[model samples]
Target chain A: MKKNDIIVIVLVAFLALGIGGYYFATRTESKNAKVVIEVNGQLYKEVNLYEDQKVEIETSNNHKNVLEIKDGYASMVEADCSDQICVHQRAIHYNGETIVCLPHLIMVTVQSDEEYSVDSVAN
Target chain B: MSSKKTATFGVLVALAFIFSYVESTIPFNFAVPGMKLGFANIIVLVTLYLLGSKEAFVISMIRIILVGFTFGNLNTMMYSLAGGLLSFAVMALAKRFDGFSIWGVSVLGAIFHNVGQVAVAMLVLQTSALIGYLPFLLVFGIISGVVIGIVGAELTKRLRVILKV
Candidate 1:
């Protein structure tokens, strides 16, 4: 590899590592994790992770997302959206993890018992 | 372009379409939504090196459109167009630079491909939350890009000898 090739490779690698480290470092730990479901940014439902339940959420008109809470983890079991992004996302149990179905404007976030702190500086 | 060259591009476009269709048949998922091995890019790389940028752009666009119509929706077509255009532009530019091999060009092409897809995702999602996926996507893009680039460059080298171009 030439000098320029090395430079490009190293540059992308370093940038990815730096941002990845920052992401993991600032993650908020959820002591008592709860599954928060929002439709078009409005709170639709909240469920405790400890409980096992299958919730069928209808958000933004006819869009539906089926969320399953099992064994202290929340997963998007099914969805009627074209993207199926939320369904493809792995189960999220930790604090600050989210499964967002963009086409349906449905956001599933995991929140801890701690009070909400709006930190706008992360962007 | 001459009729002969046009026919050649048409054949390559068909080959590109086949590569895309073949990839879809494989049971592969990286756990990242919309992530693929991008094997279709091998055709893009080869077309760019042999026929030039404009032909490469045409081939890529036609391949995306054909594949999009076959197995994907309108949204998929939009993302494919955006990603294909940007990757082709970056690869064409990288090829113009001196001393950077086809491998390097392919790597750049793949990275920009991810960047382009992310840009479209941010626009479609209408929220910055998905921006959190950038770093992870970049890491994946780099590794996959390297593999695709090496394979693409080797194929290009072999084709050059076989085709007597």
Candidate 2:
């Protein structure tokens, strides 16, 4: 194999592991932890762990999106507009979990005391 | 470009849209949202290698605009444009690298696309927190880019033999 091919192979392997690791590290099963919702850096509401309820998060853009918390696992159930990307997001159940709806500037995420920050790409 | 080349490019654009729609439908359970195989990029890759940078840019732009409009994703147009442009520029630069092939160019393009999209997200949301997802996106972008690039390169090889372009 060419040197460039080897480099690409190594790069691909490193990326796969990094991505896989990030996903596993950030993911938390909603077994015992409580459900918390935050918007625009404020604690909006917290879903009671004991109840199976659907939380409707109304964003500033007037778009209504729903998060269903059943038995502690929280996932987006429905969205008003097309391309329901948030609705398609994996269920997040941890502090500092975030699902951003760009059109609305609304971010629905779980919050943990731990800070989870990723790097920004140069322009 | 010759009439024949123009017609070929048109066909490539159509193929890109078809692949885009097809890939968009095959759902995968990934951790990140809005992540996909982006198989349609194969056409763009092939175009870049076979035709030239400028032609490939036109083709990529046309594909994004057409697909976005058809899907009514006006909000995502900016993100897609930024990502696509950055990717194309990266691929063009990759062409300058020693012994660079279409595959290398496409992979670089894909990585740049992910970076560009994430950058847009951070700026639009005015939050640096979203940067956390960049690594994963880059990793996936490279894998997907290479796969699409391989397909594009293989097709270009066959076309070079058949069409003698």
Candidate 3:
């Protein structure tokens, strides 16, 4: 292989490794802490820090949803829709982690009302 | 172009569009919005190798727009468009470097696709907080892209005789 080709290969390899390292290192297991659920800038529900608990959410639009936070591992236990994306999410026990159900527009996060971080995504 | 070549291109676009539509129906539904199976990308990659960058790009864009219309989600069009364009651009650029096979190009494309979407999210939300999620998306993107790319490359190899383009 040419010298330039080797350089390109190394660069791509480094980039892949960097991305992989960043992903694993930043993963936080919030298996045993308070869990908060919010919707449209409103405090909707809060589960006392627990290893695992099934919390059901009833939306204004007449949607039934369940969030399970167990051992700091949080996930969507159940959902009203055919596609259960929330259940697939790993529990977030970090200060700024979130699980959002775009179809239902429901956002389950680990932050409190006092934590002012960001607003809704545009479009 | 000859009528035969035109016909082949038309057929390829149709196949890509169908693949894209079918893929949309497959519910990956991760809590992370925009995360998807992207199985239809196999067709795009195959087309890229068989027909070259220009044709592959056309096929990719056509599929994206067709799916966007079928889904009828005007709001999400921006995000999809941004991601698709970014992915294709990265793959095309990587095609220039030696030893960067189709799989490598696909992984790079996937990485850029996520980056584009996240960039859009950050701009739309007017906050950098969402940027933190980039690492997670990157890891998944690379893995999925590699898998899909392999399938696409294999498919292209099989079709080479039939598609003499």
Candidate 4:
């Protein structure tokens, strides 16, 4: 690679590392984490992580996703979408972590109750 | 296009198409969603350096549409189109500006490809949390981009003499 190429690579590498570092550093593990499920950008359900339950979501498009919350973690155990990408994503327990199913327009995000209260105050 | 140019474009497009098929079967289970080796980009890069930006754009578009029809649905096609379009645009701009090598162009294309997909994902899901995926996708893009660029550079060199373009 040429000098300019090296510059581009270094710039992108630094940028990636910077954003990644910030994300990890700011990650907070809440004592009362809640799993928020959204379908087509609307709140479908919110469940406590300690509840240990299985959530089955069926979108209007007839898409299906099975989310399982157990041991203080939330994960997509199964999905009927062709890619099954959400199923392959890692289980998340920390605030701001997400498992997204693009085909079904499903998003499973972990949010701490503190953020919920903050939203309430703002509202 | 002349008969020879038409034949060459056909061959290039076919090669890109096969790369897409091969990529789909590889089962890249990388934890992070939307992570792809982007093998088809190698052929697109080769086409860019060997032919021209216009030819490369057409070949890339044809490959995406053809692959979408063969192995994927409309949703998949839309994602691919976003990635392909953004990637090709960045690569073309990089090439036109000069200074950076093929590797740089490839890496930029790969990175922006992910960015484009993420943009669409954000709009579809209506959540900014998807930005969390950028770091992983960026790192993966760099790795895959370098590999594809290496192969593409070699192919472009050899094809130049073979095709005498």
Candidate 5:
């Protein structure tokens, strides 16, 4: 491989690994976290993680997402998106963890009170 | 452009549309929602080399619109448009650089394609949290990009001799 080829390969590898390491390393699990749901990028609902709750978020544009909080973990129990990827994703129960339904433009995140001050992403 | 050139562009566009449809029919998922083997890109890369970026851009635009209207939904169209445009731009720029071959340019195109879709996702969702998925997407992009790059490079090399552009 040429020097440029090597550089490009190494660059992509390092960028992915470095950012991935930082992302996962900084993610913390907090028992007292809150499940925050945002619809169309606006705050639609927020509830404590410990509460066993099923929040159905419906957007004005006919999209729907159901957020289920159980056993201190939050998951997208249901969504109207064609892919169903959000519904199939694993539960999120840690700080900075998010379950996103791209089609519905819905997001479900877990954050502790300390970390709840507008997630780094929200900013 | 000559009628012959127009015919070539039409054929390339048709090929790209067919490849994209075939790709969508593949059963297995890449684990990442927006990721794909991008067989359609091979045509785009080949067109870029055989014809020119202008013709390739036209082909890419038509492929997205035609395929989007027929087999896919508006959501699919939006993501494809956002991703295709960026991928086209990146590949066009990367192709101009001698240090990077078709392989590198194709890879860069793949990477930028993912970036563009993720950016749209972030905007649609209005949450940076979705950016969290970038790592997974990027890792996938690298593997797929390299594969696309190699295939694109080989295809471009072989086709150039036959087309004699």
Candidate 6:
């Protein structure tokens, strides 16, 4: 590779690392985090992350996703969507962490109670 | 366009479509959603260098649509289109600038591809929190882009001599 090519690669790598580092440093573990689930950009459910439960979300389009919350973490255990990308994603427990199922238009986000309340107030 | 050029475009599109199919079957189990090896991009990059940016764009679009119908759904197709368009735009601009080598252009395309896909995800899901996933996707994009760039540059060199373009 030429000098310019190496420079571009390094710049991109550094930029990615910087953004990733910022997110990592800002991620705060919350004791009162809540798992907020949304379907089609609309709020579907909000449950305490500490409370272990399974949320079955079926969209109007017949797409289905099974979200399981346990041990202060939330994950998609099952999805009828062909890609199954959400099902294979890692669980989220820290505030601002998210699991998204694009086909089903489902998003599960972990937000602290304070942030959740602020979000609700804004909405 | 010359008939030979048209035939080459058709063959490139078919090759890109097959690459998409091959990539889908590989079962990339990276926990990050929407992450891909971007194998089909190799063909797109080669086309960009061999033919032209406009030809490359046409091939990329056709490949995405064809693969979408055969192995993906509308949602997937939308994501692919978003990624493909953005990726192609960036690569074409980089080529025009001529500041970087083929590897640099390929890396940029790969990185922007993920960015475009994530942008669509944020819009469709209506949650900016998905931005948190950008770093992981970016890192993966760089790795995959480098590999594809190596293969693409080699193929472009071989094809130029064979096609005498």
Question: For this target, which candidate reaches the highest TM-score against the unseen true structure?
Answer: 4
Candidate with maximal lDDT: 4
Residue-pair clashes per candidate: 0, 10, 13, 0, 0, 0
Overall lDDT per candidate, in order of appearance:
0.79, 0.73, 0.70, 0.90, 0.82, 0.90
Q: Score the docking of each candidate (DockQ).
A: 0.44, 0.27, 0.18, 0.83, 0.47, 0.73
lDDT of 4 by residue, B1-165 (tens): 699999998899899999998988888887898788999999899988988899999999999899999999888999999999999999999999988799999998899899999988888877899899899999999998998888888998899999998
Which prediction has more favorable TM-score, 2 or 4?
A: 4
Tens-place lDDT per residue, model 3, B105-163, is 77777767878877876665444556556656766776777788778778888889777
- TM-score of model 5, chain A? 0.80
Docking class of 4: high
Could you give the candidate ranking by lDDT, starting with the highest? 4, 6, 5, 1, 2, 3
What is residue A55's positional error in candidate 1, in angstroms?
A: 1.7
> Candidate 3 clash total?
13
Task: Give the alpha carbon lDDT tens digit for every residue of A25-91 in model 4.
Answer: 9999888889999888889999998899999999998878899999999999999977888999999
Q: Could you give the interface RMSD of each candidate, to one decimal?
A: 2.5, 3.4, 4.9, 0.8, 1.9, 1.1
Docking class of 3: incorrect
Of the pair 1 and 3, which is ahead by DockQ? 1
Q: Which stretches of candidate 4 lie over 4 Å from their true place?
A: A116-123
Ranking by TM-score, best first?
4, 6, 5, 1, 2, 3
Q: Model 2's lDDT to the true fold? A: 0.73
Q: What's the TM-score of candidate 6 when only chain A is evaluated?
A: 0.91
Misplaced by over 4 Å in model 1 are A32-34, A38-44, A59-63, A80-85, A102-105, A112-123, B162-164
Judging by lDDT, tell me the better candidate of 1 and 3: 1
Instruction: Tell me the deviation in Å of residue A37 in model 1.
Output: 3.2
What is candidate 1's lDDT per residue for B12-36, written digit by digit as tens?
8899999998987876644455566
Q: List the candidates ranked by DockQ, beginning with the highest.
A: 4, 6, 5, 1, 2, 3
Per-prediction RMSD in angstroms? 3.9, 6.2, 6.3, 1.7, 3.8, 2.5
- Residue A50: error of model 1 in Å? 4.4
TM-score head-to-head 3 vs 4, winner: 4
How good is the docking of model 5, by CAPRI class?
acceptable
